[model samples]
Target: MKWVLPSLLFSLFFFFLNCTDVDYNEKSVNRTSRKILIDASHDGGVWWSPQSGTYSASLPHQGKLMADFLRSYGFTVDELPSFSVITDSILQQYDKVIRAGCFGTYQPSELQAYVNYTNRPTSLFLIGEYLNPAQIDQLAENLGIHFQGIYYGNLDTYAPHIITDSATSFYYNAGSIIVNAGTNPAIIPLGWLDGDNNKPSLGILQHPFSKILFIGDINGIESLPQPLTLKIFKWLFG
Candidate 1:
């Protein structure tokens, strides 16, 4: 009876030690509750815009890599119908939007819907590129940010911001940005391309309600490290 009782105690202790506590939670980006919408190009996905046959970006895979990266984390990502018009209801459902203006035409109402979305505390990642500046402008104009011409590359130049410490140098072909005066005064310029007159390659808007990380290079998004990308998203969502 004495041996039997000791054996039972030992078995119980081993079971408790070996069992995994599935109930415990790890500290991570609180992004699982936030929903993301990828509304890029005129098509279904973000991969359609800002492309040149391996020549445009540092290494061109377009938006697919970014979309995959975001999803690799637990964030919920969705695509609007390529032909679908953006509306208040749709935008409201998403915590953030990832946009690459390549060939999409935003109706006046859709732009207004975005205005409504941003009027609240919403965030966005606006992708930029050298090609189709006009098309990119259509979506960005609503936010009073404009994407301009090209710059070959930059070794590294960063503003004092959260994502700056996450990466060493930006390695992609990027475009320039001209942020308007009256808009998000909390503008923090992120990176620059040094080839043509120190053109700015990235901009971040850190307003209380409207958080935007405007990436001026389509290929730049493709080249971003996952930790850096998550940090950028966390900042935007925060």
Candidate 2:
């Protein structure tokens, strides 16, 4: 009877160790398995070269740097080609969607698809710089935000948010003005240009199951943006 009890205790000790190891492994895998989709299709001024009779990609250097930066954090980053469209199936494959420096216009169907996608449990990061004013307005309207076509510069003001610290100051070559169009409780302003507290230069909208982060300019991808960009990515991946 004494030998039997010791044998049972030995078995239980090994079993507990095995269970703890499995849980640790599972947590580690989950932490590194996060997926991010960087939509490069609309960026980089993609066009066909008639002389070469082939398509070419003029992807922004900053966008490429952003992808590399994300990969360094152990996140699986997918840079979709310009020919790719944001579809329901495509959106499902990623936990976060980043639309950066997109100048191309979206079709009505594609816009509707984005609307549907944003209404779901997803995270969208919208970065625009010198994009089509009409397209920007369209997107703002769809998101229930007001976007003025005018570009603001010399912005020395910032609202404190997850992506910025109290000492952080930001300036953009050019940026659009965005503000909440209605009294939607879900929309929250993140930052604003100096002397212009009424309009938001950066904002986040939280839906029931989804969230959207809007940046008026692509300066966040620049080297000077520094900790702001890093903090933004952390917030997104978190």
For model 1 the TM-score comes to 0.70
Stretches > 4 Å off in candidate 2: 1-33, 44-60, 131-135, 152-155, 181-184
TM-score of each: 0.70, 0.72
Encode model 2's per-residue lDDT on 65-119: one tens digit a residue.
6676666666777876665677767776776888765555677776787777777
Candidate 2: C-alpha lDDT:
0.63
**Model 1, range 55-162, lDDT digits (tens) per residue?**
222234356576666665656667543456788888888878887654556788888987888788777888765644355566676676766665566536666677
Model 1 residue 184 distance off true place after TM-score fit, in angstroms: 7.3
What is model 1's C-alpha RMSD? 8.4
Each prediction's whole-model lDDT (CA): 0.63, 0.63
Clashing pairs in 2: 41-82
Instruction: Quote model 2's TM-score.
Output: 0.72
